[model samples]
Target: MTLEEYKKEFTEDDAVGWLEIDKEFDRLYPDQEPKHYAPPISYMLGGEYPLDGVSIYESKKQTDHFHFVTYGFSELYYNEEKVNGEFSKWGFELTFRLKPFEGDNGNPPSWAVALLQNIAKYVFSSGNWFEEFHFMPANGPIRLETDTDITALVFVNDPEIPKKQTPHGEVTFLQITGITSAEYESIKDNPGTAEELVNKLRENNPLLITDLNRK
Candidate 1:
């Protein structure tokens, strides 16, 4: 899309990027009924979260991973940068493929939702960004309810969703996967170990499953 065309008509009419992303998703799962979750009206009015919503789709790809895609990480409005050509403010929306927690039934975990929101908040507030293979320490259990020692997470570009070009800029899809305690320590001791972990993950599981039992 040309800068003039995008700024004048496209972005002006539709401020939501979610619909476009949804179309990309639908192409993968035709007519799938993804359980969509939008924050309450109050949250939109004035709340801690800035995202418009999150959509959770049960994946039949393998191992019953719950695919969580978030909205509001990219330019969701007719902002001035639509013409500036600097990728989306953060250039990526977070995607998570998680194995179902045993007691959670088929319901998506709210903590996963909260984690996405907090990451969005960090980007919007601190101007920090996440990219493929970028890792972060949770300082505690990622899933607070579980005793699993997967305390830190490593980011990888989502395999299913390719980077898309939007009027605002290019939006990349990043997936977060939990890493084992030993991997975290390796990263802590040698920052370069993170790249090794990413390589190992790609070798072992191209999908990057969060295997708590992984040593």
Candidate 2:
């Protein structure tokens, strides 16, 4: 659905601030866990020759960003030992540029809250089929804007797979423009008859989340 349509249906509460969608897939079918990778290290032996050591390491990364700021999460796996396994979490360097909005005089718009809730619902329902799903606002500055368009960065889990990714199972970045509470109320009262109005909003302020990446 269009952003304005989505906003009208869901943005009933003002307390809603941010929304995110996250998904999980079976990295391995038949209940097998994905293999972990290791980093190779070289060490000096007997102060003469160099020796190589193989060190086991986790093989995944997670990140999130809003408006030139970023936040990250962790991935953990349990081994047969039930105690020994792999754990990796990066709460580090990543960023995105924030678009300035006329209404955001330092205050976010009310629509942001509803948008975030809808995102959470979509992710939870779609990703629940996998083993687990994790969702959280990547700590940073995410705001609504009127001047620029934003899109989600789409990426593939396996680049070798050749164009398997559709507009699904990826991050969704939203852009807000020329929208106000009065306009929203008009659409709500009109229901399905407001296609022209919806199109106007879509034409004037496009909302898209494209270019999803796996990094």
Candidate with top TM-score is 1
Q: TM-scores for all candidates?
A: 0.88, 0.24
lDDT of 1 by residue, 39-66 (tens): 7752458877878888898887857778
Candidate 2 achieves a global lDDT of: 0.25
Instruction: Give the 10-residue window scoring lowest on summed lDDT in candidate 2.
Output: 48-57
- Which candidate tops lDDT? 1
Clashing pairs in 1: none
Residues 33-143 of candidate 2 have per-residue lDDT tens digits of: 422211133111222111111111122222111222111111112112211112221211111122334454534233343333333334334642111111123222223
Model 1 residue 157 lDDT?
A: 84
Residue 106's lDDT within candidate 2 is 38
Model 1: lDDT to the true structure = 0.78
